[model samples]
Target: MLDANLKSQLKAYLERVTQPIEIVASLDDGAKSQELLGLLRDIQGLSSLITLRDDGTDARKPSFSLNRPGADISLRFAGIPLGHEFTSLVLALLQVGGHPSKESPDTLAQIAALQGNFVFETYFSLSCQNCPDVVQALNLMAVLNPNVKHVAIDGALFQEEVDARQVMAVPSVYLNGEPFGQGRMGVEEILAKVDASASTRQAEKLNAQAPFDVLVIGGGPAGAAAAIYAARKGIRTGVAAERFGGQVLDTLAIENFISVKETEGPKLASALEEHVKQYDVDIMNLQRAEQLIPGRDGALHEVRFAGGASLKAKALIIATGARWREMNVPGEQKYRNHGVAYCPHCDGPLFKGKRVAVIGGGNSGVEAAIDLAGIVSHVTLLEFDSKLRADAVLQRKLGSLPNVTVITEALTTEVTGDGRKVNGLSYKDRQSGDTRHIELEGIFVQIGLLPNSDWLKGAIELSPRGEVMVDARGETDLPGIFAAGDVTTTPYKQIIIAMGEGAKASLAAFDHLIRTSAPE
Candidate 1:
């Protein structure tokens, strides 16, 4: 049931859609179809701009379509829209109504100039927040072009398709019945992968003869900050990264970003890239760094990529970030993006009115519990320690919530799920030597973080935990090289902290350059 506050919010969001959007429901005879139809009726009644129509003729499953008044669109959803995907559905309708696509002019022109026909089948789970972005991007491409066709499938509802295609994860994209890509990707990236002309030739390799004055590795917050600071000093700055936003793109909410009260991961990541473009940093994205070689005779240091392309720089700043730690237990890997997820900020909304569990008793777990308590029906937190490791203030807030339960000294045994999604979790309590299973729809694992420093294996001095060792000024054992962010021994992993460390590393590199020579 929609509350007054939510109804008001939906009303505001729908007011922006001035144009009328026609929805056609293609459903088979079943209880699931009835449920989906009921929800659609409720949504249609929310605003006069939404009009619902019945299409029982060519229906194979409980599917629906969104289009303009006269023409059908490429966007279709095969199953009930619930969890985080509800936002995707609303956005699709709004975009078809009046809201223009957010792609840049260059991106729109590229989509318009596409000559060949392409059909995209994207698989998704309702609880996955990352799946919506890819779906929305593909839908936008379809809206911008007439040759492209797109469909969003609920993986669980269509198990035969999942089994046949081996769809193991959400956002699993297929182009013309062949695997194109998986996971989160930008609109331009998806277009490039499907567009023939864009993928016909190899990218231009790097030139080793020319060297940059300073090269910043990784395109996360830390690397971006370093590149910006160094470029401000009029140095020839360059940055190489596998992706522009790094791990930030995987994050969901940003309540602790300072000054700004709240933000989403992708939004902040986009802004970060936009800000870095204002500088003179030579951005080389989608390139993974493999090896690092020290400079000879005070020449440029060499950084090698996977494809043998290499860059030469006088000084280097390593800001390679970290990824979320996994449970590594049974069902954890099998049910990723199905019922077990690593990011609460992105996937929390999908669990609204559903019971969920948070593993770990640290600040993150407690914070997750507190945040989820407002939306979900209940939150059960499991801690492997005798006492909670979170701050007293956090503990106080956690205790105040009515829908939260805390279990201490418990070891998570396994994540239990059906073949398609998670349903429960098994845990063993240390005190009583008892095993218990909790029936919940989702499990959030926030135990810790693992640095992405395995590639630097023997090249740099690393701690036992694989964190790079650096001094106060972010200088590593290798004199001309510096490390920052979670990859370094910078204590904590946070956006603001990483940004500050990046700035510090850039200044330290600038000081090193002055001691040697100007941007010679």
Candidate 2:
């Protein structure tokens, strides 16, 4: 039996629902034994019925079946539908129900006319918080046309599946059981891929042929700057990106960027985009570059986007930035923005007078905890390793802070909260083997960073930690190709550093052009 208040809330949520909803529960030994059956029955009573199954035989099995009654919607919960998971489930339901009204009928009809079923499976690590937008976009497409099915699998939980599928990074999407694309992509771009995949299978396809003077691979600060500069230099530049702003868009504020004392990430991106449009920059938003090969003369590069569009460029510049690494623990993704945050500068003010937890013992972690202690009511610093890896001065300063509690040998295992937001975290002491749960309103995760150069493969040399290698002038080992911004193996990854690298890379590209094409 479920509580009256919980049932009432669920009923209220289902009242406006206009589509089908389903929940798939895992019955593993370690799974929580809550009253989920009764809740499923209640959901069935409120909305159209859909198939649901127990993962008793195999936890990895995809058990939900869809029977379209003109418009069909479905929601699956692999584990206990509580905390952040419940919110995701509810939102997924609402999205499926409202998707038809959101898109035009002709577009929906065009999608439905496709003969073969297209299944898009997107693999995402819980730590990669930027992946939700991609998932939502695909899920909306799935909702509109029953021919399209979208499945989101947790990368860490399904490591064997990920290995078999050769999924090396987060936010990777597979179409029709084949590796379709990777990284964060938008709705229009995904639809284009779906259409291309369908057309290629039906008829003999020819290679793409498009020409441009310059091709910028990323749409971040450096990429945008390079495109604007090159366009102003009278070169026909084309900028292709999965999404504009790269990882910088995840930041809440740009405090250190020049000229702007404090600007939000979205605002800065908008301004950069406006400035780029002032020139002749051909912007291809929501497009991901799938491959890049040097041209015959070595001065030109052939770049192919995910949707099979090709562009030839005389110069190429890579400005892809880095993404924040995650602390792989349960509930971390579920509570993101609600209480779990990666940037202290972004969500610190919201925790005023509230207890907060800071994960990691590195310099960034210690500094963030110290800075947040002033704003929050209390700060708990949890470090998995034996000792703090921060500098001596920072360790001494943090040790002296009365409001900060440093717990060495502590490893966070789970984040616990109500359906809407985070409330606390559970951890275990490595040495003592004792588990403890701390009630808090916020958790800050600082586990270093991951560069966005995995897709480059061996085409360019990379540092020990996977950052692209660049010389003093931002020239990569590959001739006629340049690397810039945080993706490069630069000492600092600040906005000022990225901007300087952008300018250096542009100048280096110009010099390379001059040397190769002299009027000798």
Candidate 3:
């Protein structure tokens, strides 16, 4: 039981006391649990001793009514409040308790008028140690604004919830029940999103605002690359993206990308994002473009976001990349992290000395099988086609590996798993029409990728495969519009190729701007 002083402090901190706060202990030891509970109670008691005054100062006033009336704030700690994470939690609590202004005076005034509650849910895995920083930043925002409610859900512990949310990566955050952002972020960037969301709401309450310039769609390699170039070229640039890295974040190691010999997808995305920050680019992560229209000038374009805000750009660059097609068979999504994986590099190391299966006969599949054979106990390569579609050299190399077993003309039908994790997969022989199941600990899906240009529709001319068409200089059919990287109908989708396209597009856009500005 909590002491009177501690209970009073907890009550004061809570804006609404509709129900008693439940404390769930994650500690395994019984003795340790009791010790931790006592420690928490002590901390609560200490918190009550401090009082927040309106004069931007804290007073030692002993009162249970310290909370301002009508305050509807809530704090959510996603992980165990330990180590550096504890400091973040404390800061968040202080910001919430004091109701400090986190935005500009105008922005704060606008946010204060917001009636609807804004909820932010951040999903994180325990393996990702970098997630705590994001959790702390969100907590602080919730603390500063009474209208904001923040919750952090553990990705692994709450597998069902994670699946429902489609949480593929760690440190993923959602705003108002929709996917909002991902990866680790600083307090300022987090607060900026909150402000942006609030501002959008405020504008909706009113009507019509000026459109933005240089709306660079997508947050992956091409989009980020375009924003960096546009901003550096003295244009007001804004990047609207569903996620920061597109499919690139899903990759584990990128060896083919030039300059960097070997790097992880997440690390590469982070570096590219950092480069964009060096310029005046406004990166709006977790924001999706729902519609596009031609601007008044006919040469420019306008993009409307899902959040009810619109941006206008003198030039538009479609950089939305592709997503790997998933095997929608049963138990596939359920056991995604447990055994079923798409990227061999991201989760391959975890299955060392275990039986693993690789689906598809493409270059990616053969490469994954060859890589896994070096680490795992056994590697089974399954190909739906009669012959491997990979390069001759790769096909020969994969066949030469003694540990790799090739199953030609095999198509996966089902992924069977114990309630907790995957145990094996069921497949069918395409030629013989025989179905079979193989026992394995891990499965890697390496099917071909689908371009992300479906959203463009006929607004931009695309290839038969739905890839944006670009010229040698990365110029699209439309004047003042250009594209680059994998999203375009470029022959190569490698990292180096994408980076080269990005550079070429930047030069093209710069040249266009210069030519148009010169006196005739």
**TM-score, one value per model:** 0.75, 0.54, 0.61
Maximum-TM-score candidate: 1
Could you say which candidate leads in lDDT? 1
Candidate 3 structure quality by residue, lDDT tens digits, 1-520: 4567746654464443332222223333345334544545544445433332222111211101113234556655433444334444445545544535344575455545545677888776433444665876666556556777777655544555655664555577788878777665655456556565654653363225344346677878877777877787787677777777777776765777766788767678878888888888776665667776754334557777766766666667777778887888888988876678776654564566779999999999999999889878999999998998999989999989999999999989999988767789999999989999999988999987888776678687889888989999888887777888888999867766776677678778767766653111
Q: Model 2 off-target regions past 4 Å?
A: 1-209, 296-299, 328-356, 361-379, 383-404, 408-443, 517-520
Total colliding residue pairs, candidate 2: 0
Tens digits of per-residue lDDT, candidate 2, 117-145, equal: 77787766543434555666666666666
| Candidate 3: clashing pairs of residues | 96-143, 212-312, 214-313
- Model 1 per-residue lDDT tens digits across residues 1-520: 4557866777788888878888888887798888888878877888898889877453447888788876546778887767667777878877888787766786788887877878888888775657887888888877767788888888767767776665545678888888877788778677656665553232344553368888988999999999999999998999988888888887767899999999877778889989998988788766678998877556678888764578888899999999888878899988886778766655565566789999988988888888879878999999999999999999999999999999999999999987877889999999999999999988999898898888798889999999999999999988779888989999989999999999999999999988875233
Model 1 score (lDDT): 0.82
Model 3 scores what on Cα lDDT?
0.67
Off by over 4 Å in 1: 1-73, 76-117, 121-132, 152-182, 191-210, 348-355, 371-378, 400-403, 416-428, 432-441, 517-520
lDDT of 3 at 399: 84
Task: Kindly indicate the candidate among 1 and 2 with the higher lDDT.
Answer: 1
